[model samples]
Target: MKNIIGAKLKAYRAKNGVSQFDLALKSKGKLSTSTTSTAETVTNYDPRLSTFIEMYRYVDTPFDELLTEMGYGESYQSTWYKRHKGNS
Candidate 1:
């Protein structure tokens, strides 16, 4: 799982044309470069929830889509997205 997510994160960063240091600075400490490196190297998989969200924002990807790709249940959007995004 860590390997999968790490690869995805590295891909996303590449797609956005940014390095890990740039990403961490852009996130304004919402996510750390160390954590980003961890995610990329398969050394750390459990990034903070806030860091995960920041990744979505940084990559210009929708959070719902990310959640789906993460293998969240089909009912997740219906059950959690609205509440999580304060749309409820």
Candidate 2:
């Protein structure tokens, strides 16, 4: 799971042209360079929700979109989900 998130995070960084150090500084220590580096790595980088929020704000990307990229968002948009939502 961490690896999955890491790959997505890496893509965002590449798109934004921000380095690990830059992310750390921009986030004002909510994210560290080490954490950024790990999150961009190919393994072992499950970040906290706060990190997701921070990145979302920084890059103007939806937090749910990140989850979707990790294949965790479809259920919410699936037929079952639509039925469940209607019931609720």
Candidate 3:
């Protein structure tokens, strides 16, 4: 899951043509400086919900899009239904 979130963050940053440092700067004002720093600190960290929301605000991307872009397959809200759809 952390890897998925990291992949999404990296993809979004790439799509926007921004470096991690640039993202950190942008995120600082919208999210928290610590959150931004944590994101930039490693390549595989699960982002907090607030972090995703803040990133979406700054990048004009939806959380679902981000999740898809990161290869999450289904939205978090639909995970259980998606998982159990075939079983039921």
Q: Comparing 1 and 2 by TM-score, which wins? A: 1
Candidate 3 lDDT, tens digit per residue, 59-88? 545655656666675645476766675584
lDDT of 2 by residue, 1-88 (tens): 5356556556767888988788788788888888777666646556688876665665544655666766677665878765675474
What would the per-residue lDDT of candidate 1 be over residues 1-88, giving only the tens digit for each residue? Answer: 2334566668878887888888778888776788888878865477777766666665544555566666764565674556667554
The CA lDDT of each predicted structure is 0.67, 0.68, 0.61
Query: Candidate 3's error at 11, in angstroms?
Result: 8.7
The alpha-carbon lDDT assigned to residue 50 of candidate 1 equals 73
Residue 12 CA displacement from its true place in model 3, Å:
8.0
Distance from true location, Cα of 18 in model 1, Å = 1.2
For model 1, the local distance difference test gives 0.67
Worst 10 residues of 3 by lDDT: 1-10
Estimate TM-scores for all models: 0.66, 0.62, 0.45
Higher-lDDT candidate of 2 and 3 = 2
What's the lDDT for candidate 2? Answer: 0.68
Better of 1 and 3 by lDDT: 1
Please give the range of 10 consecutive residues that has the lowest summed lDDT in model 1: 1-10
For candidate 2, report its TM-score. 0.62
